[model samples]
Target: MKQMYIPVNTSLSFLLISLFATIMPAQAQSAASAKASAATSTSTSTPTSTAKPSLTVTATQVGSGQMATKLVANGSVAAWQEATIGSQSSGLRITELMVNVGDVVKRGQVLASFDSEAVRADLAQAKAALAEAEATALDSIANADRARGLQASGAISKQQIGQYLTAEQTAKARVAAAKASLDVQQLRLKYTQVVAPDAGVISARMATVGAVLGNGAELFRMIRQGRLEWRAEVTSADLSKLTAGMTATVMAPNGEQTQGKVRMVAPTVDVTNRAGLVYVDLILPKDKTAAAFKPGMFARGEFLLGSSQAITIPQQAVVVRDGFSYVFKLNPDQRVTQVKIQTGRRMQVNGSEQIEVLSGINAGTQIAASGVGFLNDGDLVKLVAPSAAVGAAPAAPAAKK
Candidate 1:
């Protein structure tokens, strides 16, 4: 009905309005579809993730045992009691020697013999002089006896008797003097046999065959009683700890080990070296290692301080981080726990470096043997065979090209 008054412009306006109404339904449908698609995508889509990194490691178990705490030093093995056997008689030439170096001799055993020809000659001359004096004294004594017998009668004068008594006294004195000289020569002959002062091992021979030695000239040096000792030189501090009963081990140049006991601790320190000596007595029965070790051998010694139980591990298990020692211990969950430990003595057992753990770790614990330089606490690590790792961890699996 309104079209009776509608103009051409009004008709165009109506057409434009109808066209806009038709386009609105299509736009609403498109928006509803887009909203539904966005909801479905938000509810069912998968999330993106990143894989964590891990490390492979090699490890060793904690070692548990007793390690002897010891104080180490160097010293010399020597005779415990050295005796210098010397010539007691002067101007005597050695004729025969019955012993040499390294010979075991007994007390009062003959060691050498001196030439007794001079001694025998002196003794013979004294005996001849004594015989002459005895002959003169015999004639004088007979005259004295006749004089005494005549004194009871008138056989001789009193003055003659006195002269006979004086002659007899003089002749007896001469005989006494000759006899004394002969006895002195006989005593000299007895000293020709040189004998050992005590039972010992001969270490040195200064007297050669036919050696004319003076009185008190040394002929041999021996270890009295065949006893040996180790004179270990130690700092003043270490010397104080050694007592009379402490045990020690001495290793000779030939790698022979001998056992000894602390015999005495030196009271004074040496001025030059500022060190003191500890004398250790060696027990060398003929059946023991006594024959193997000799005097003047340079040996290293160890004084065992009383020992207690300790826990130890390979040196590689210990990691130095920020001036602290740490070890990675394997846990029940197949993970590792970083443990801070106190390190004690570092020793070698069969060419391997084994360290003592004082605290923060226990026996039977597993630790990373090596290659722990970059590991953090609570980090997951793969355990690899020790041999597989050249020096550290085994090479990782090659990635796909």
Candidate 2:
């Protein structure tokens, strides 16, 4: 057997070459892979570096302005005073109904009439009795005069003259009683006609023809003076803000607005609700049909509490998410940061609807005027000029091309 001897250096060199060959290809492939990954990363990150705007909006600045402060309250429309018309005479049958519900009536106007035949007959009988009593009184006067003249003579005994004088006095008393009865009967006859107590609109009628009513039976109900008042339920804290003369604007359910003056504030607050009533006298419109407010109708009112400096923003700028109100404030970087704001009174400023920012934002802070609802917190936004934000008139369709 022949033994083959090789050079150790040569064999080591060859093994090193083989290992280098394998490692070089792997390293080259690894480098190429790394370069491809880097390129992919760069391409993916380039779009994020130049972030696109989420929305295009016009910027508005919070402004300080004098806005009328108001205290809003809900209440019911009621009559200033309600009068009940009732029968003054008992056992009187209603013969005629002259008025019905919703009829405007004046004081002393006949609303209904009762059967007066029985009353007139009683009056006639009383008149006859009075006449009889008057005639008897005249006779008594003559007898008393005769008795006085005879008292000085013996033709009439002293005891007999005294009896004649006593008889005369009794006859005079009977005549006076008969006159009183006559007056009562006359009054009864007058009560046959039910009259209005005050000038007002009839709200309810309960009397029916041929129905007999007892004394003090209600026949009709009226709103005194046709005056409607709003009784606003205000919290105790706001009660003091209202005086007897402050102006209140009340809105009816039909969207009709009426001006009113505070008549009075309730003296005591309701213990259960911790609220007080403010009575406001409404000034009805000239046209009765235009005054849509009616008794018992629910209404809302605002008491102008005078003007106060407020920081306000356009109403459209505020976005409500979940249950909180937010406004997107433009940062120096042209990005929007969602700011939670406490809102107060909403009012019209310069023909635009604005809402008072009670807290959270300061005056002169730039915010997204519109399209805020579509934006999120920390979103990039492109702000256009106010004039540019509004679309142009479409260039008149380019003159029909």
lDDT score for candidate 1 against the true structure: 0.85
> For candidate 2, what is the lDDT?
0.89
lDDT of 2 by residue, 1-401 (tens): 12334576678999999999999999999999999999999898785546667677899899888999899999999999999888999998988999989999998999899999999999999999999998988998898899999877789898888888998998899999999999999999999998998899999998889998889999999999999899999999889888999999999887888899999999999999999999999998877534689889899999998999889899989999999999998998888899999999888767889899999999999999877867878877777888886863211111212
Residue 217 of model 1, lDDT score: 95
* Number of colliding residue pairs in model 2: 0
Quick one: best lDDT, which candidate?
A: 2
| Cα deviation of 287, candidate 2, in Å | 4.4
Estimated TM-score per prediction?
0.61, 0.73
Residue ranges of candidate 1 with Cα displaced over 4 Å: 1-68, 127-180, 285-288, 308-328, 335-340, 345-355, 362-401
Give the TM-score comparing model 1 with the true structure, all chains together. 0.61
lDDT string, candidate 1, 93-112, tens digits: 99999999999999999999
